[model samples]
Target: MIPIDFKGKRLVLFGAGRVARLMFSRFPELNVVAFADNDSAKHGTFVGKVPVVQPEALRHLEYDLVVISTGWWESITAQLQALGVAPSRIVLPPKNMLAINNGEKPFSHAPTKALALEVLGCVADFSARHAIPIMLDFGTLLGAVRDGDLIPWDDDIDFSLNDHAYPLFVNHLADLKVALPKPAGCDLDMTVLEAEDLITGVAVTYRNAVGCNAIVPFEIGFMRRVIENGQSVTKGAGPSFIAPEVHFHNVGSITFLGKQFCTPDDALGYLSYVYGDWKTPRQDVTLAEYPMQESEYLETSRTLV
Candidate 1:
């Protein structure tokens, strides 16, 4: 979808986390009058030039609407109502409206175990052919580290590349796929997504035998910060890290689908750093996993062929 244009509309984003930053950049027409957050300490701070105010400030501020970007939108909406912003003035972002840099689609489905492995092999081979290294991330990492294979309940694949290697691969994704010595039998499509010259996300997608859209998604970012007990996660900073750079500083290999794939040295700690309940399997998954998003510093969107 084309990036939304909310020009001239004054907007007050409720949460100042990962999703909020995506909203901030998705709408170029939006005249973000102010940002509201419960974090009083951050009130005087700025999300770019726009100031973040205490939620209560919405009572007296003149704006068009209060955009609730947090997961707890119900509570935030009621809070905004009590703060005197009209109920109709509050809204949740349209479905799949979140900003994405990875080559991802608004919708995706899982693949068969064989297809999943093939995708992984394709990525590894492609990376090796070009001399670019890739790291397993998110559920894909969990599967390798936890079960040494893709999670049965999982539907896609994930990997990470340092900011530098990501674009190099994305720019040549299609050509590389076409050049694979013996490509996977599945139909393949790949893309590189960008906003304002920064790579956001990339995906190698294919249709499995079951007619499911299997995606091997990659995000470009650094694991920059630490989390606390999984209660508070840095939002809107862009996740797009399986672990911090230091953890990935030492890399090792794990047998995934009978092939050696790279993983972080402190695999358990890296898992803990991202998903706290790493030991227990949470089979229930959605596109909305990885709660934080990197702040979009600019609003330009482009695609590389």
Candidate 2:
């Protein structure tokens, strides 16, 4: 990704919709030139005081980059390209349609005991290499193993880095796979997160696809959030800690391989946020076991490479 030098550069964005508002609200530091949309009604409208313009008006100003901020990637990309915007100068937000189109769904399996341990190994290696802080977050905090069997859960291994360590992690991610998520099609999957410190960093999540008899894979992306003010903080504004909800009626069957897989309710709440609006059996446990011994600011020592 090219470094955004917004010092005096103009950022012309297309489609002043929800996604655009999300980006504009999150990153107010950038110099926004204006909004461009095909709808004639919005031509003279203003999005947060940034004037909306017709695409024809774009030629009047020299813009550093044209951002396709619309969620409808296919349509927006086509529109921007039709305006003769050089493909190289057109940038889409991370995890936009282009990025999703670039990769395939991961495969699913009964994760091994070694899986979580492998993440731990990666964290140890990453910490040694970077000499930075990384925390074993959320589900990964559940102890390494209990009672002779690996905790069989669909969750992915996750870890966090301070803003400073993020770039180094991204730059060397390929070489450090042993300390990071295993080989997937793309080298690194990136998402910008909101943090309490207002410091930006990437939380790495692993993915697996677990649909049998289906031609195209059904993907499950592992989810993780950063630790702030002694608890986990999500992508939402501030002071957000994951509060697990328990649903306990349907146990012993969580719908895996045509049979219900055992997913605890508290686990389900966390997974709900991770996977986005999933319902589980019922509430079993609220406070699931985590790996860290709570310390100052409730930080966990566990990490990923």
Candidate 3:
């Protein structure tokens, strides 16, 4: 998941905090030779039997990679670079790990869980009122099923609507804006942007009263069922690979933020098809980077639908 092949490679974990301990525990295959920390008190300590040394020790030690386990990666990276450590050998932890456990705050300074739940609730209510079928998609769906909440590092929520529901929901954009709540001391707004070949949905944003532009945007993707090479597949707006139509045929519910929301009928299977290892949290790549061959969909063609 860290994107590095650990086989026969020596590793030095920088920062002897919880993040370092977690990395050591999770990766049994890592040849962690030592831990480098800046704190003087931790210089002589041990993290899971691996001795901790000062950052200066790195110059004398031989290792293949130096994993920056702390959330303060920018400063640590600069420190490592000053110490003459190769940028190629330094690795940062996944965004999920940093946001969930490393004291990294979510965007807009809003409470991550509370804001995400509020936005999701609004969307759910609107869908129900309009009788428009919608389902969680991409990272939003993965976070709901895997983490039981929005991924703290995620900037927005993702929802999917079929071609039929897309236009209907777009037509009732005014109703959705009315439904969006303007909590006291906050300003909320929504707008729809159009592309060359498709109509993109609106993004719900929240701005605080103190002139802080803390926005939690949510997007609805328009997906259509079409035949590709005699096989039924699902295609979304913009250039994207076709997915198996079966995954989007029905909707199911999952408990997210202590409330039930719709998801693809086979949530687990759908994730597996999109993200090869849905259980692992990754920040190095996104859904857009995933190739069609990596999924259960049509493998012969990588053509964008």
Tell me, by lDDT, which candidate is best: 3
TM-score of 3: 0.53
TM-score of each: 0.53, 0.34, 0.53
The residue-by-residue lDDT of candidate 2 on 107-216, one tens digit each, is: 12333233444445655556556654444333332322111222333234444443344555556655555445553332333343433433234445443344322221
lDDT by residue (62-145, candidate 3, tens digit) is: 899888775456667889999999999887655333222222334334564466577688778877788887778878898888
lDDT of 1 by residue, 32-85 (tens): 888888877888988888989999788778888777776666567678777777
Name model 3 segments beyond 4 Å from true.
1-112, 196-198, 207-210, 213-238, 291-305
Candidate lDDT values, in order = 0.59, 0.45, 0.65
- In terms of lDDT, the poorest run of 10 residues in model 3 is 296-305
lDDT for 171 (candidate 1) = 62
